[model samples]
Target: MNINVERQKMADRLFLVAVEGEIDVYTAPVLKKELLPLTEISGTGVTLDLSRTVYIDSTALGVIIAALKSAARNRCRFSVVGMSPRVERLFTITGLMEILRREKIAEGDN
Candidate 1:
């Protein structure tokens, strides 16, 4: 997997993280490392753009949940966007959809 992370400043209190890659056990740590800093930003919100991610495994999901918890502790908003159908299904089957923010968008739209 190829992973690329880009940060865009949406506003003084909001930031967006654009991620591209397959987030499996091997790559989940990359995401965690990239996002850990955001957890320290008290009250600032973060939106994760997962539009380009092709695959994710349980380990990745765990990492994401951990990130969300960290965000909550910091009083920051955490949202996920652009999950592919298969990935969305995985979240649904795993009951993560109810816990994590899942944004619906047409494929290739983002």
Candidate 2:
């Protein structure tokens, strides 16, 4: 499947990536390329909004986990938000929900 990834800088220290469509092996690399750089922004906070995502696989999860680790090493805050029920269940099943900071972003509240 395919995915569309868009980004917005919410503030001097806040960055956001909005993803739509499936996050599978095919699309995971795109996400990694976009997300890893954001994590390198020292002292910044990076958020991944997956509200519109329809699917995710292990490869996608790995990309996110790598980004999370990179963020930690760079002193950046990384959060994953707006997960649909199915996606949230995956996170729970994988025990990543406990590790990831899950928060919802209100419309226009960035």
Candidate 3:
């Protein structure tokens, strides 16, 4: 299936982008579109809520990584929250978790 993207302004500088459904090749661009611009703004804290997301392909993963990198470069905070067990395993086994751990981005998960 496609995806649904919902954005929320949590604070003056904190934005929450909640993605539901599947994030695959076709839908990854949508996720990127919603995410990259937020990272471009300096000091913007972007939290990606994936609680409702059930599936994500490699393209989507790459988009997420790129967003995180952009957030790091722009000095904006980026973190992911409420990942499902399957998706969480993908992040862990692919070493993306290590990359996230090493990067000085994203604040508390809460």
Candidate of highest TM-score = 3
User: Which rank order by lDDT, best down to worst?
Assistant: 3, 2, 1
Per-residue lDDT over 38-73 for candidate 3, one digit per residue giving the tens place of the 0 to 100 score:
999998899998899999989989998999879879
Which pairs clash in model 3? none
TM-score list, all predictions: 0.84, 0.89, 0.91
Among the numbered candidates, top lDDT falls to 3
Lowest summed lDDT window (length 10), candidate 2? 101-110
Tens-digit per-residue lDDT, 1-110, candidate 1: 77777878899978887788888888888888877688668988788788888888998888778877788788787778888888878877887786663432113322
Ranking by TM-score: 3, 2, 1
lDDT string, candidate 2, 50-91, tens digits: 999999999999998898889889988888878888988898
> What is the Å distance of residue 92 in model 3 from its true position?
1.1
Clashes of 1: 0
In angstroms, give how far residue 66 of model 1 lies from its true place: 0.6
Best of the two (2, 3) by lDDT: 3
lDDT score for residue 15 of model 2? 89
Give per-model CA RMSD.
3.7, 3.9, 2.3
Which sections of candidate 2 miss by over 4 Å?
101-110
